[model samples]
Target: MKKWFSSAIVFTVLAVLVAGCAGGNTKSGTSESVDANKGEKKPVIKILQNKIEITDKVKAMVADYNAYNPDVVVEVQVVKDYLTMLKTRFASGDAPDIFTTAGYNPMASWSDKLVDLSNEPWMGSVSPLTIEGMTMNGQKMGFPLAFEGFGVVYNKDLFAQAGIDTPPTTFSELKAAAEKLKAAGIKPYKEAYQEGFPLYHILNLGFAYEQDPLATLAKLEKQEMKLADLPFLNNVFDVLDLGMKYGEGQESLGVSYDSQVSDFATGKIAMINNGVWTIDPITKVNADINIGMFALPLTDNAEETKMPISVPGYYVINKDSKHVEESKKFLSWLHENGEKYLVDSFKFFPAFTDIKATDDLGPLAKDMAAYVESGKGITWTQSAWPVGYREDTVKRIQAYIGGQGDREQTIAELQKDWDNRVNK
Candidate 1:
């Protein structure tokens, strides 16, 4: 811990002051659960995570951990809209013992309420990038869940069938490839416009492609820069335009995530804008499908193209909880003993430097890991965007795609929303 992060844990000795503190303790599941046979009570560690995809596996891991250590119990609750629900939980004095935070701006907002895990033993084994993302005021506040990569997940067989030997690495090449795919009677792209995430990824690339993404983000935060003012912001839409032209046109707005991934799996489309997390779902649909991933280029410069690799979320313990130590214990246990669940069961790529990803998570993981190892990956800029920006911006872009507004109108609305919401 000293070698990695030497900061000491500053325990919150003072009781948390809230309107309903007693109710908070009980509702957070920090209260002890009595064991009938032993006539003893076990403290509960409640975790509220956002990834609904891994809910079942997380429950299985919790069961294993509880069985291994009978004196303590751990429970996990998965939610779809995590940030809104997390804020509601804290506002109602019902915060979980441990909850997920995406770090950066969000972590800064919740820093005072998070326990200091700077001196945790496992802290030494994790990646420096993970530490950088989760740290606040020189203190490590969260345990990184795993590394995730997102871009254009494409079908290799379709590319080969189209005579495209080399996958696109630049905006020009991507358009050319799309042309080839279309000429080969293959639908080039499936824009899952029904989902906010894919569209958010496009907008995020506008910032990520900037010379200094953080400085650009600061400008946007301070209203010194607007989304339309971005040099490559139009280029972001150029990529989306390829999808709009070659994909299902306006009907792409009706393509849900499940249907998009399913279509990609069935070779109905050559590529889709998604992440490595979709591998399992796609495999479930078509195990024999050959696939690969590439960076979603935002510019004609090949040098600027890179995959977006990030720690999607991190686990932060509630400083206000009575079972803070127990929550820490559970995290430590998971880090030390949950390799099987993390790798095989959850199909996660370990974010820890010392812990190798033993099983091949998927083809997308392989491509992402290569980029990560080669320093050709970019950080997720949306993590630092305003909390509600994605949801609002996604709708704004969707409205444009749906013919409710033009591109100029979409940009104006997004900028107006940012000005209204950034400071709030």
Candidate 2:
């Protein structure tokens, strides 16, 4: 699960920090001048982020801020597997002034190292669901940067060619459609259990089985409920079973996200269960592909149910940041200006209710926007799960998909694990 970080890079960073901190104070004139300048003033804010390439819009925004604010300087560093880097920095007492956490578990674990932004001016602009995901012990520990919705992203042309009139809105219909596509010589659904995350994406659809999964999750955390007692887990097993039923072949383990996406883009697959992030790959293959989206089709009342949606990205400030005010100012600007950047660059739907959907979005994005406006969507499953349970549950799903485990055994294991963790 932590394969994102390479061991050599971690060792190199630790070595550098150790060497820098262990050096004696042999003060040269230049060093003294630098220290004096630091004391006298200009605020320096360091930001640690994953090594994702920045969009031009974000770069332009940063440039504008840098040109205007001479008193504060922002230095951005790209860290591979940012969470590992964060842990290393925390151990060394050299963490950045600001960083990003993937979800609630990491946020909760590092809550003591983050500043509570509940009173921040921009807090009111965010949604209550997002606040709940980012808050720890009733204090806001992070600010959501963007929102995303996931479902079956399908090629309209392919569906039409297959004589399918509409997207599936229920589990049975979805299975039938997959079988039809398969018989038509097109893989009905393309999944990447090899990546691990995509398997979790399928399990997340189980939230739709419950009346109010989010509320139930909260109760489970308080020991008022057990995940095993819920019927949703069984429904989730059925969903995973569907994916395995239509998977490509025996070498499914060799299938990566890129290959699955490529197959979908090339019209080899009718649909793929993914979020807005899949848009880029689709566009790259064929910008003209007519794309459409629908929820997992798990619920009986298709029109009344909403797809699972949540903030896809987050921004958090370091608890030990010396320039807290400056960091907060940057965060404010980020919340205000970041939406346009997301829309223009990544086509991400902004979580801010006041923000309007732009015409620049792809067909699928536009459809998802309408879905959200209908107020039928729920929060992302991973975001709502208790700390430590999310990843373990995902691994279980992967094991099931690989045919190494059974649904009952998987659910029983998860129930026991979650029960133990929540109790502890």
Each model's lDDT: 0.76, 0.65
Pairs of residues clashing in candidate 1: none
User: What are the TM-scores, per candidate, against the unseen true structure?
Assistant: 0.89, 0.84
Residues 118-218, candidate 1, lDDT per residue (tens digit)? 99999887776667678899999988777777788899999999999977988899989999999999999888899998888888887777767778888
lDDT of 1: 0.76
TM-score of 1: 0.89
Per residue, candidate 2 scores C-alpha lDDT tens digits across 1-424 of 0111111010000000000111122122111111254464455666666634443444455556656765666665555566777788778766778787755666777788889898998888765556666878889877766666777789888877777898887778888888787777777766766776676666776654466666777787887976667766677677666776787543565678899889888888878877766777788897778888887776456664457666655678887878788999988876666555544554555555454447676676677766655555665667657676777876676676667778778877777878877777
Give the Å shift of residue 22 in candidate 1: 23
Clash pairs for candidate 2 = 306-376
* Candidate 2 segments whose C-alpha is farther than 4 A from its true place: 1-41, 51-57, 222-225, 303-305
- Steric clash count of candidate 2: 1
